[model samples]
Target: MGLDWAYFRRPYEELHDRHDAAERQEYLVGRQPTAAAHLAELAPLRKREPIPASGYTGDDERLWQIMKLYALSRVSDYLIELFCPAGDPPPGFGVTGGRAVMEGSTTHRLELGGWQINATPGWIGSRRLELDELAAYTGFFTDIGLTPFEHAETFSPFHHEIFAVMQDPSATRVILEEVLWPGFWFGDLLFSRAGVRVRAPRHLIDAAVATTSTLYFTFSREPRPTSDLSHNWGSNSQWRTSFHRFYSDEDGLHLNWDGQVDIGEDPPQQPADQSDDPNPLDQRRELLLHRCFVRSALPRDEDDRFPYDDRLSLTTAEWPLRPESIVRVPWTR
Candidate 1:
């Protein structure tokens, strides 16, 4: 079922009422607003029930799984609209029946409504190309957690796991460019799905970076090192010494470049297997549905967000990045 817009509309009104009141106070008199307010504004409309595990004869759980995924995708899109810079993306940014249709399918630019990079006034061809390239990664999966199956036959499970990690902003962007985008590009052989173009308001990115740095460095780090965990401690030690460590760490992640590693190697091509290989576009659909899967699994407890299955780490081929591209990071990052 689609969003219960009527049911969800009142909270928006309440938020606006509060916002207007706050504005009249010169944004000063009341308790400082927080993301909690934003979360509460968005929380009421989501589906909270489960599909019957045993409903009909031969009813596989996949249908319920698909429904859950659909819900997550819808919610993620809604959240992005709410939290991400652009407000209320146009209907065009979404797919028909509120579904993610195909692997390489492009969404209507809802937030940017007819304000495409190519169409934006004063945008040069290079800028347009960059946006297109960036969108190849971000627009398709912005704040969404689904993974495509066709591109990487191995992706079905891994994508679900990554979607879980995306709940954390720092981890979200990091995983998108690292684990997800590269997989989409080399696995699906799609050229544009290789990088992220963040058009985020500078302040939000800055705030996120600030929040993340403190969390990762001071809070998440271990207080002392043990011999068994020496590697982790060493890494944390390296991380602690960096300038504005969080920004540097996140910048490296956003760019997907560590510079410690060498670049210039070609992605190894997957050998065609007739039995397992499906149509390339179908693979893209698999990928999109995987994203839908993640979207449907939202509002999970923080611990549930990163379901790292051991099966996923079995192969390095599941991750891919062009050697040359690795050396050249996105200018925006």
Candidate 2:
């Protein structure tokens, strides 16, 4: 037997009507406003019974796990959209789908949505070259409609800081202490991602900066499940099914970087087989997801009528200017 599961991102009012009309009517009569309020009212519905049963089949359990994981990932993406300044980014800017190819140590070619962004690493021990390349990449992103700031002036401080830090020999430590550490702390408080809480930011930063590399950030929407088996398994499977074609309103963001470190100059390494495992490196991307999600979820005091303020500024005050703060921070060596 195939396991089936469904999930919906519907309003609490809709869900309540389908599952328990009486209770929904009572809440509606009270004149409660806001989806959050309705959701709180319907919280009890979830505990009434397991969709299938308290004791689930093996297949049911497997599907449940997949759904839960997917849900958390969706939540993560939602938070990113909420906090990241680049609201509802274009098909490029790491959204949709893209590929990054390293043409040389300092140059990379990014292709997405029939557009291309050629990025030359900006901070590879050459101040002039780095600044020029940063300007070039900024223009490239702006042309593609992924402008990093609401106001062009906001870019000045960021550019200065990046250049200043890169020139200093203690750049790695400064970035960890001032940027990554604080950003991660702020993120942990918002997203409730326990995994990020236990790790040391110093170690993570050290690893990333240890090598001369080019980083590529990519975001893509998770494909919706199409199998019939995934659609028909539970008593309340209809409630679990996601009618929407996409996992999130936005794409799933992924961070990838490539570089080479001097084996002799750095600490001893594990054997080739052990070193080939991608989990440790992949965790870096997960850490970034947590950071962006929490930042995007940060509350803003703005006009209720205009919920989305594209002019909303994401500066050092609003969001810590960390390496992982933006949707994409491609550093070249």
Give the 10-residue window scoring lowest on summed lDDT in candidate 1. 305-314
Please report, in order, the local distance difference test score of every candidate based on alpha carbons: 0.23, 0.24
Reference-based TM-score of each model: 0.20, 0.25
Summed over model 1, clashes come to 21
What's the alpha carbon RMSD for model 1?
Answer: 21.9
Model 1, residue 179: C-alpha shift (Å): 12
> For model 2, how does the per-residue alpha-carbon lDDT over 142-215 read when each residue is reduced to its tens digit?
33222143212222221211111112333333231121111111110121111111112323322212111211
Candidate 1's displacement at residue 238, Å, is 49
lDDT tens digits by residue: candidate 1, 1-333:
332323222332333353332242332213223312332333222221222333213354333332222222232222222222212223322110111112332443221212232221110111011222323334333222223332333332222222112123333222222232332221111111221222122222221121111111111111111111112445323222211100112223211111121112122122243122222322222122222122221121211111110001011222222122222223211
Screening candidate 2 with a backbone cut-off below 3 angstroms (N, C-alpha, C), the clashing residue pairs are 6-240, 6-241, 7-240, 7-241, 7-242, 83-296, 122-130
Model 2 is weakest, by summed lDDT over 10 consecutive residues, at: 302-311
The lDDT of model 2 is 0.24
